[model samples]
Target: MIRVFGMHNIQPLLNKVYPKATTANGVYIYDEYGKAYLDGSSGAVTCSLGHSHPRLIPYIKQQLDKLQFVYRSQFGSEEAEQLATRLFEHSPERIYAHSFFVNSGTEAIETAMKTAVQYWQEKGFPSKQQFITRWKSYHGITVGALSLSGHPLRRQRFESTLEKYPRLKADLENDTLEKLTEEFVQVIESIGANHIAAFVAEPIVGAAGTALTPQAGYYQEMKKVCEHYQILFITDEVMTGLGRTGTWFGIEHWNTTADIVAIGKSLGAGYAPIAATLMTDEILEPIKNGSGLIMSGHTYSGHPLSCATANRVLEIIEEEQLLDNVNTQGEYIKQQLNVLKENYPVIQHVRGKGLMLGVEFDPARKGFQQKLIERCFQNGLLVYPSVGGPEGKDENGILVSPPFIISRSEADELLAKLDQSLNEINQ
Candidate 1:
């Protein structure tokens, strides 16, 4: 029998019931009792290629046969180099020239933060150490990334730790586009723009029910603000990259490029733990001209096996033309969600781009979220709830990000399950 070796009372993602062990192929997961469930949310928006893709295992095995680890500081491997080249090729041309690999999204953010600070110091602006980020955004769970994040629930326990740092002004929902731009400009000015190192944000906000997309021309305006202040614009694309948003990167949808881009989740297609921070030549020039050494690195920074897995994942995406599938399937999902909104008065909002959609429930309907989850689970579907919002507020929403390989029939199946769940919950 499988046994969990932790406190029995510690809660899991779902509080009402303990999860059962299971196994399955592709996008399906099985419970201990042999019940199959479709992974509609792609396991918190990872698994873009789906669970246990046959190609990934062979590639990983091939790499493991050669080498597993290569110290980033002293040693390098061909797999890492090839993966970096692939990432650069896939990104906007002339934007990302170099990559720094890490084990997770949080680590990538931490690396990006340090790189920004060092870039300023090397460029003779030593006082430019402050970072700006938006509210309801998630960078990662590590200290540096957490410090840059504005998720209230995640920051609740560590408030004091962040209070001591240079605080970035948080954006509120009620703020109009003009108000936001004005406030952002004023904050940079007040802080002495030259003293700020970087302004970090997710192009399309995730975690907080996929929040609001920037207003039309908002990002262009923000880029101007950053350029005016000589501050680096770092886009956290951990959740929105690799065709998840019907583009190579979500920020690309806005036609804007960031100085530094942190990618994870779909980077390795959930087959392995690997992340990368890609930066422009301008950003790297300072470091190259100065110390010529990246001050941050981990032992497994360029693990060959993970790199191999990621490389294969990218190959599969391109070979199969998954981006086209994402665009087509994403449109269908959006259309279905809109229909759901029309049918269910309880669905307060249906928002998001591509496969990364969110369905926010109205609080007036008590027990809506729990009932929704239960009904969905019973009907062989799974989704994740929003990370923050008022308790019992039904700020609870479903994240619908199925694998890129999902077929039209599978999409219909998901919609049927979702409709059945919503209808049952309404009763």
Candidate 2:
């Protein structure tokens, strides 16, 4: 007999009917009962290469044979160094130089925040300790990250414990680049720009539903403010980085540069735990000239096995032209979702870029999101629920971010499953 704790259930003793995952292969996870679940969510948008990848296994084994772990403070690994070089090759020119590897997205977020603060301190602005983040955005789950996040349900219980930060609420309904820019500037002014260290956001908001994209020129306008105020701009790409968004990074869509980018989820492609904070020379040079050391360090920072796995993951993505696949398949998926939205009144909207798409249910439809989630599971597709909304409230929606390698047939199957599930829920 085996037991496990539920992710958010109140009863620890309650029996959760989680299927025992025995194996996974090519966009599907199979249980001990041999029931296959289409990995429509890519295991929370983490598995970029599907599962049981033929090439990844060999690379992982080779790295494991050579080295599995190394404390960053005392040792260095070729895998980590090589991965950093590869990241720069894919990065925007002169925008980012240093990479700080960590174990998860939350750690990456923490590191980015700390790095932002350190940058300001080293530049003779130690009082620039405050942060500004957007509402309806998620950075991570740690207290610091949560403080920067506006996801309602995730932060309600720990509201008192989280750090206080100015939250900008963008009105999607009446948004104009000029108005949004003014709003951003007002928030900074109210917070006292001199006291702020950074402005952080997900280039494409995840976890809060709608993948909540901003208006055109929105990020550029915000970046302008950050640049003028000497505040570091941070883009949290934990879910939309790599090839998931049809580009190397979500920020690329806007052609905007970030001072710090906290990336993870697909960094190790669900094979191993790894995340990293990529910082610009502007953020690092000041620190380099001052203390000559980064204050943050983790035991598993740049773990050799994880870095080796990520390097191979990047290699596979580049070699296989997965970015092109994400572009083509993502457009087809969006077209299908738009058709579904047109056919069903329950689907209020469809949003997001590339594979990181979302379908929001009518808020007026009671229990619709939950019913759809359960129905999708019964139909053998697993999608993520967009649980919380702005200001710690529950929102009704589903996020669909399958692996970048999902084929046309797999994409069709995913759409079919969703359509069937939605039809059942409607009936």
Each model's lDDT: 0.82, 0.87
Q: Per-residue lDDT of 257-362 in model 2, one digit per residue for the tens?
A: 8999999999999999999999887788889999999999799999999999999999999999999999999999999999999889888779888899988877
Candidate 1: tens digits of C-alpha lDDT, residues 351-408: 7788888777776666677678778989999887664344212346667888998899
- Model 1 alpha-carbon miss at residue 163, Å: 4.2
TM-score of each candidate structure, all chains considered together: 0.92, 0.96
Q: Go through the candidates in order and give the C-alpha RMSD of each one to the true structure.
A: 2.9, 2.4
Predicted model with the maximum lDDT = 2
Worst 10 residues of 2 by lDDT: 4-13
User: Candidate 2: lDDT over CA atoms?
Assistant: 0.87
